[model samples]
Target: MRQWLKGLALFVAITCLVWVGVLWYWQATSRDMSPEDIALYLGLLPLVVFGLALLARWALRSAVASAVAKEAAAAQAPASGSPALPSAGQQERHAPFKLLASGLSCAAGHSAREVADALKEGAPRPAPDKALRDDEGLPVLCARIEPLDTAALQEAWDGVCAVAQADLQGAEAQPVAVDEAVQRALAALQAPLQQCLSQLAAWSERFAKPDADGPQAASAAVPAGLRVFTAWPTHWSPAERAVAQAWVKHCLKQDSADWLAPSQLRLMPSTQGGGVALWLEADRALRAAQREGLPEVVLLLSCQSDLSDARLGHLQREAALFTHTMPKAGVAAESAVALALADETWPELPDAAAAPVLLHRAAVIQRDKPIDAAGRVSAQVAEQVVQQAAAAAELPLAEVSALVSDADQHSPRGAELFSVLVSQLAQLDAAEDTLVAGTLWGRTGPTAPLMLVALAAHRAEMNQQPCLALSVDDSVARMALVLRPPAAAGAEPTKTAS
Candidate 1:
């Protein structure tokens, strides 16, 4: 009301000034006219000036409104020949998944704690690759993991082979031959997968033990069924994927068979952003499991490694996509991340040592244009996804304490993310709160998205605040979700020991 009154007063003052100027001009031009004629002209001037001012204001408002409507329609429109996404109502129907545990392996470190510590210190700088060079004869920069131990990888492979042999013996099939390429891929994935399973096993054991607090405390039994979802890069062949699946089954049977049984093993392969897709699949599976009254734990795992000369050479050859310029070109990197997710109704959830972080349903939207299309980069799609995800989680944008993304140093990706942060999540300090996994780990291929999720979960748990994870690596789509820390209990939330 105050603002409206102020605008009215200003309008009136401008109208009065215009009327006085017109009356003076009339008087100067009509020196022969009577005083009565001058008085009538002055009396009519105020009404005419007021009418013109109102008309101009209406025209200006109409123009502004029309422009806004056109911009909104363009933003919501899909690209030519692109399929329509699900309605917001349909997306909101998805239930939140409980994050029981997480595992990570990257150039910074092998364990989640180690990786988080390294990230906290500062942004990582990529070193020049000794084997790969760009068009300018300069070495390409990359963030490569340290070399793995040959003896241990071989030992693990032998066990997998032994398991494969036993299964084929009954069918009189030939022994599976080991390929060098398969070995290298398997080695890249081994560390994080093993670490994830070990942690899950330990958690299961703890949950099964009777509570020491009192008899009234619930003594929860471990779930009998397990569902594993694994994602590999598109560059890997079918044979390699089959072997990787077999290896995972063997590991579970050998280590977890006493308390858990594998019921389903799904393989998801994609050129990029496979980790985000894997999580979405897991959420769907959980909903189906609930409908069928099945109690099961789901494991989401993914890994990617581009440390080889062949791989780096391929990237270097793509001049349009990659260059030697820092913060403009992508750096070759490798990483692995695993997440153990379960329904909120799991029997042992309440008795767990730490409160589980909740993964709200993700919102994925198609871009109106391709990332490489000739034109200005647009942040509309990215902004829409983030807003939708936050809305689905019922979280206000101001409450999101940090932003984590798989966007590399590429200008388009960086610009898109920066726009979202500045416009939507202005509450966060970009330098102190934003974590770019790609800059730290380089382009980790399929593993980058999951790595972002893992890092967000860790940060949320530590700070007891919500963190947003964004997947902007895909060229055609953008995805975002909220990782919210559990609500505060009477005492403060426990922090992870350093």
Candidate 2:
């Protein structure tokens, strides 16, 4: 009200000054003019001009009001049969998955704890690649993982080959040989996969009977019906994908306390939607397992590396997608992330000591427009997914403590994500409450979404509050999910796992 009054007073003062100036000009220029001519030129003309200005201001206000009303109505309307805002009871019917453990191998660090710490310290920065350059003869910036020990990877590869050969002994199948490139990719994935499976094995051992005699007894105590969902790069060939799948299965068998046999393994390889899609599939698989009375433990894993010169050169040639400018272009990166998800109802799960981090059902939707198009990109899809995720968790947007996203410095992606955050979570401080994974890990390819999830889980556990994880790196789809933590803990937790 005070501001409005001040504006009105300023307008009146300006109008009075204009009228006085006109009157003085009329008198000075035409001293011989009649009084009637003076009144018509000075009084009436000024009055008419003031009235027109007022009329224009009113018209502009009305148009703005109308647009606001239309946008509000559209936001209230459901985009599909599943309402954007579900009631608490409706949300409760959809059970959330418990995030038992997570592992990460990225430019930042080798474990979830290390990665989280590195993020806190801002350790990983996009640096110029020594071997890759853009069209302008400038080095391309990238977040690169340090090269692994070749001898160790080779030893692991030999074991994997032995396991594969033994498993296929009598199946009347031809031998599968993976190319050097695929083997390199598999080697990149080995660290995170081993770390995640080892964590799960350790967790299971915690609940093993005190009287259990040996390692076999602890292995027997490990949960059955384990499922593995792996997301690979779309560029991998059919043979490469098959070999990668075999490698993942063998890794699981080797790390899973000897309880997860090759015959009992259920491996699903996904080449699209990255880690977000894997989480969605894991959710569905958990629900199906519940219905069939199977164990609900599942592992979601993904890895991608663009550190190679060939990959970087290809990105440079694709000028439309990448550029020499750091802020506008997507930075090439290498990363691997693995998450262990389990149903809370699983008898083998030690409920008392489990970290209270729940991954709510993810909401995913496709954007109607291309990401790189000019003009304002509507935040409707992104907003809807966020609302749906919060609703599924039975939590209000206001209660969300932090937001983690895969949005980079690229304008379109950042704009879309910022629009949603500003509109839906008005209480959040942009600088303090938001974390962008791309800033730290660059563009992590298929590993991005899960990496965000792992980070969100870690943040929630540390803050003892809910954190939102958003995946907007996809060209046509937006994904969101909420991670809820316990209301209280003795101190800040170091990792997402129990």
Compare the candidates by TM-score and give the number of the best one: 2
Best by lDDT: 2
- For model 2, how does the per-residue alpha-carbon lDDT over 10-73 read when each residue is reduced to its tens digit? 6677668877887688678876768886687666766677678779888999999999999988
Q: Where is model 2 more than 4 Å wrong at Cα?
A: 1-93, 135-137, 156-184, 203-223, 257-263, 325-327, 347-356, 487-498
Cα lDDT of model 1 by residue, 1-498, tens digit: 997897688667866786677668767887565677556655656556667877998899999999999998887775544546665444435456777767777777776567667777754556787876665777767676666544556777766765656644534455566555346556666666666777667556433434568674575443335678888776665545556666766655665654443443333332233666676778788878876766667887777666665665555666432454534556667777778887766644455677778787888888988675669999999999999998777678998899988776565888899999989999999878987766677766667777777888888888888899998876677889988776632133312111
Clashing pairs in 2: none
Q: Give candidate 1 regions above 4 Å deviation.
A: 1-94, 131-138, 156-182, 203-223, 262-273, 325-327, 349-351, 488-498
- lDDT over C-alpha atoms for residue 208 of model 2: 34
lDDT score at residue 373, model 2, on the 0-100 scale: 65
Give the C-alpha miss distance for residue 111 in model 1, angstroms: 3.0
